[model samples]
Target: MEDISIISMLLTAVFVLGCLYLVIIPFFKDETFLDHTRKSHTNGATKEALLTTLNEIEFEYKMEKLSESDYRQLKKQYESQVAKLMRDEETSTEKAIDRDLLAEVEREIEASIQQKSKKGGGK
Candidate 1:
């Protein structure tokens, strides 16, 4: 009896842990689910890196280490890339805001319906 009870307890614990792994783990592990903050951090890092490289190129040119043509070419490329990143970041932010607004609207609609149903039922 003691051995059976121990085995049953162990099996229950394993089942619970398996259930948590299947259900709860995905919420924590899903990188794209609610990751606006991470996106902004990545954008900041990319912007900073581009600016740093551009400055380095300028410094090199000032030191006469880079030819004028090469300096201008690199500067133009980095600036364009930076512009694209900024545009993409803005778009992503807008999308996130839209999603939040939609969710809020849905909740309000649901609440209004529930309230109407309750009032109707009470009458």
Candidate 2:
């Protein structure tokens, strides 16, 4: 399949999932994949944007623009986003560790090959 079609289908699946999550899941639940990236700080962007959004959220709460329940709910959302960013950071760290381990194994194998060749076992 074409790349665009793959992406379209993936997005459609995500939309369906988001609708279901919004409809059925209770508050304080996990977010979807798209939400994870939208909430990601992997780009090294200053957390200034997030802090700004949170300031706005706090203002809304303080000004009585948000009901107590709504304020709590949105605060949960922002907190969840921060949690997701941390999780993403942990995931990348884990991935880098795995890659380092793989490279070590590859280097060992290459050294073994060179040793064999030096011993005149190479064709």
Candidate 3:
């Protein structure tokens, strides 16, 4: 009876350890069951994510998981969002270029002024 109790205790400890490993291992490894089954929307989806979602929508439509109307609406919405994002990015880039150009021109003007002052003073 003591031997049976010892074996049961050992089994219980092993079972608890196994359960802990199953739960804790993923935490240490930076993974989880949801990682495989769901998309990460934490940082706001990127252009690539939008493209992926579009593809997924198409696939779902083909599989009849989405209706034709739903697919069309979703596709349109994603395309619009992508277009707007691209436009915003382009505008920001243009503004940055303009700022850089202005800074360069200011530096050139300052250098020209310095040279003129030096030449005039030296004379």
Tell me, by lDDT, which candidate is best: 1
Error of 1 at 38 (Å): 9.4
Candidate 2: list runs displaced more than 4 Å: 1-42, 46-48, 59-67, 116-123
RMSD, one per candidate, in order: 9.2, 15.1, 10.5
Write down the TM-score of every candidate.
0.54, 0.42, 0.54
Backbone clash total, candidate 1: 0
Q: Model 1: per-residue lDDT, tens digit, 8-119?
A: 9999999999998999877668677458678778889999999999999999999999999999999999999999998998998899999999999999999999999999
Q: Report the lDDT tens digits of candidate 3 across residue range 28-104.
A: 77556577434333223677788889999999999999989999999999999888777876886799999999999
lDDT measured at residue 34 in model 3 versus the true structure, 0 to 100 = 74
Ranking by lDDT: 1, 3, 2
**TM match of model 2 to true structure:** 0.42
**lDDT of candidate 2 over 25-110, digit per residue (tens):** 76566768657676555434535555667789899989989898988888788777767776777998899999999999999999
The lDDT per prediction is: 0.94, 0.80, 0.86
